[model samples]
Structure formats: structure tokens, C-alpha cells
Target: MLQLEQFEVRERKLQFIKEYDVEKIHQAKLIVDTDISSSVSLIELAHMVGLNDFKLKKGFKEIYGTTVYNYLYELRMQEAKKRLLNSSQPYYLMI
Candidate 1:
């Protein structure tokens, strides 16, 4: 029972989210592959994703069930775990 305009708008938003996820994956890959710092600035990432600071923070939480910063932290942590498991890094570093 949705109106046409509303449906179109929802579709567009979903498309944007899909693209955003792809971009996140690409950025994560870059972080993994390069010596770049795992640190990502909030405002900078928001700008890269085509959203203002607050909207990006709120919208990302709404869509992803977690805050933007926490999500990135978890991602980096997971990557670190992988590296620790696969490489000869000291177990202390994984903690």
C-alpha cells in the first residue's frame, strides 16, 4: 500500500546503502593491503560516503544496528584477529 514516489525514494535509498556497503568493503581491503593506519576519521568517512556528519552517523546506525565508529572498530578488530591467527604475530598483540 505504498505510494509510487515513496517506493521510488526507498529504492533509491537502498541503492545508496548498497553502494555504501561496497565502498566500505573496498576501504577495508585497502586497510588490509596497505600500511595505512587503521584509524579512520569520522567526518572524513562520512564525507566519502556522501553524507553529512550527523546524518551519516545516525543513518548508518539505523541501517546497520550499530554506531559508525563501533562498526569500524569491530571491523578493524576482526582484521587484526585474522592477521594474528594467520601470521606469526605475538598473541599479546591480538589482545
Candidate 2:
């Protein structure tokens, strides 16, 4: 019974978050993942998603389990690793 009550509390907390907030967070992630070369500022991205910077940061971290800056860094590193492994030419020759 105690566990069920705690689960209900968590569910209520999630319900308190507006649907738009979830949509905006998804938009931010899509933009970041699909356009890796984009140099848009965090404020600009937040505005594009119709959110303020603070809410954007909070919602993004809550949903993705990491900050936006860290997410971008990880994606970039993965991309670099992929290219290095899949490059047609030898790594030494490219240097």
C-alpha cells in the first residue's frame, strides 16, 4: 500500500507538467539531434520552442536525464568516433 501511494504521488507530479512542456522538450531534442552543426544559443533554442531558458533546462534534464550541454557533447563525441571508424582513408593519411 505504501509503494502504491508513492507511485501515485509521482504520477501526480508528472501530470502537473503541461503537455506543451513535453512537446517543447521533444522539439529541442529533435533540433539538436538532426542538426548537429547548428550553433544556436540556448536562449534562442528555448525561444524557438516557446519556453524560457530555465524551464527548458529543467524540463530537458528531467526528460533526458542529462543537461543539454552534456547531451550535445556526448552526441558530438559519438559522431567523431563514428567518422573515425568509418572513414574511407587511413587515419594517418588524413592527418
Candidate 3:
């Protein structure tokens, strides 16, 4: 039927969009990890990845099992620990 064919086409288009959005979500995570020193907000990240905040948040959580802020916070804390222990502290002192 003509209606069935049209529905299939529309569904395929929606699937394409969903795939693109997933790629953007991964890109957003990479951006955050690559620039851990810079303070990037949720809206900024969504804009950078060509997604809206709601989709970014939802997709990111679905894929990564955590919110963006929590992920960023964990990375920042780990980076801070690395820098603090490796910069001035003696090798033995670090351990």
C-alpha cells in the first residue's frame, strides 16, 4: 500500500537522525575529555555537537551510564590528583 511505503520511508529517516545524534553524543564526550582543563557547560557541549541539551543528556547517559557533569567532575578530580602528585612531589612520596 502507498501508506505503508510512506511510513517505512519516514521510519528510515528517523533512524538516520537517531544514528547521527548518537555520533554527536560520542563526539561531545570526546570534546570534554580532550579539553578537560576548560570549563564547558551542558548547553555549550550540545551546541558544539549539533544536538539539543535534552537529547545530549539523554543519549550521553544512556551510552556512558552517567551524567555529563559527573563524568567531567570525575575526570577533573583524577587529573588534579595526577598533576598534584607528579609535579613537585618526590617519586617515593607519591607512592
C-alpha lDDT score of every prediction, in listed order: 0.60, 0.85, 0.84
Per-model TM-score versus the true fold: 0.53, 0.78, 0.71
- On TM-score, the candidate that comes out on top is 2
Q: Candidate 2 — which residues are off by over 4 angstroms? A: 1-13, 90-95
- In angstroms, the error of model 3 at 57 is 0.5
Off by over 4 Å in 3: 1-17, 89-95
- By TM-score rank, best first, the candidates go 2, 3, 1
Best by lDDT: 2
Where does the lowest 10-residue lDDT sum fall in candidate 2?
7-16
RMSD of each: 7.4, 4.3, 9.9
Task: Give lDDT tens digits, candidate 1, residues 1-95.
Answer: 45777667656665655566645544533443353344567677666556566766655654455666676677767887788889886888656
Q: What is the lDDT of residue 18 in candidate 2?
A: 81
Runs of candidate 1 exceeding 4 Å displacement: 1-38, 92-95
Lowest summed lDDT over 10 consecutive residues: which window, candidate 3? 8-17
Q: Scored by Cα lDDT, where does model 1 land?
A: 0.60
Candidate 1 displacement at residue 7 in angstroms:
19
Candidate 2 per-residue lDDT over residues 1-95, each given as its tens digit: 99788767666665767888989989999999998878888999999899999988988876676888899989988988898899998878865
How would you encode candidate 3's per-residue C-alpha lDDT over 1-64 as one tens digit per residue?
A: 9978876766654564578897999999999999987887899999999999999988777667
| Residue 52 Cα positional deviation in candidate 1, in Å, after optimal superposition | 0.9
